[model samples]
Target: MAAPSSQIDQLADRIERLLVRYEELQRTNALLQQQVDSLTQERESLKSRLSAARARVDALLERLPTLKNAA
Candidate 1:
């Protein structure tokens, strides 16, 4: 039979380990969430710039026909 004191100590150690793991996971989750938010903002900014660039390209394309007719 196992000693009662050793059994209690083992249980306590397991609980402590679980708590530590939980805290580590919590921290990792928070860091990942922050990174995700930052990436989302960057993606939105890039999309906006892309849209503006496309508009400029379209305007230039529209003028090409007029330029060719005059040549």
Candidate 2:
């Protein structure tokens, strides 16, 4: 025996809702992955900048003795 038309319609609606929720979850996962990638790149860039700044400071410190002798 076949299911009543009303029951089949209800099942179809439930399936459609589940599909929509699945799609939403997929989109959320993709966005989170992008955020992680962006944060990783930013961290690397900050580390590079910090290293360059430290090198500049070290060079200036090395010149201090010569400047003191010349004064």
Candidate 3:
């Protein structure tokens, strides 16, 4: 049978490794959140610009005379 002290040492080593991996994952998660926020802001800005452009196009279309009116 293995000594109790050896088993305790093995468990401690595994715990340390798990902690390191947890920290790395936390950092990676933070980076991904930042990217998601940046993309969301960009998407909102593009949507606003598109809405403005569509409004201008609609206004211009209103000014054009229809074929029925031309006849």
Candidate 4:
């Protein structure tokens, strides 16, 4: 009876430790997810700016021929 009771206590202690670890891991995962979302938004903004810049460059290039002809 004593041996079984000791084993049960040890198992309970282990379970408590595991629960604490699980909670810590959950918080870390949530923080990582937020970082990923922030990076994704920043990447999208940079892509939009790049696209706008490219369009401006293309428009300027299109006008070069007309400018040259007028000269």
The residue ranges of model 4 lying beyond 4 angstroms of the native Cα positions read 66-71
Report, for every candidate in turn, its global Cα lDDT versus the true structure: 0.97, 0.95, 0.99, 0.96
Order the numbered candidates by lDDT, best leading.
Answer: 3, 1, 4, 2
**Each candidate's clash count:** 0, 0, 0, 0
Model 4, TM vs. native: 0.84
Candidate 2 colliding pairs: none
Off by over 4 Å in 1: 66-71
How much lDDT does candidate 4 score? 0.96
Off by over 4 Å in 3: none
Question: Candidate 4, residues 1-71: lDDT per residue as tens digits?
Answer: 56998999999999999999999999999999999999999999999999999999999988777865888
lDDT of 3 by residue, 1-71 (tens): 88999999999999999999999999999999999999999999999999999999999999999999989
Q: What overall lDDT, based on C-alpha atoms, would model 3 receive against the true structure?
A: 0.99
How do all models score by TM-score?
0.88, 0.66, 0.91, 0.84
Model 2 residue runs over 4 Å out of place are 1-11, 66-71
* Native-to-model Cα distance after best TM-score fit, residue 23 in candidate 3, in Å: 0.4
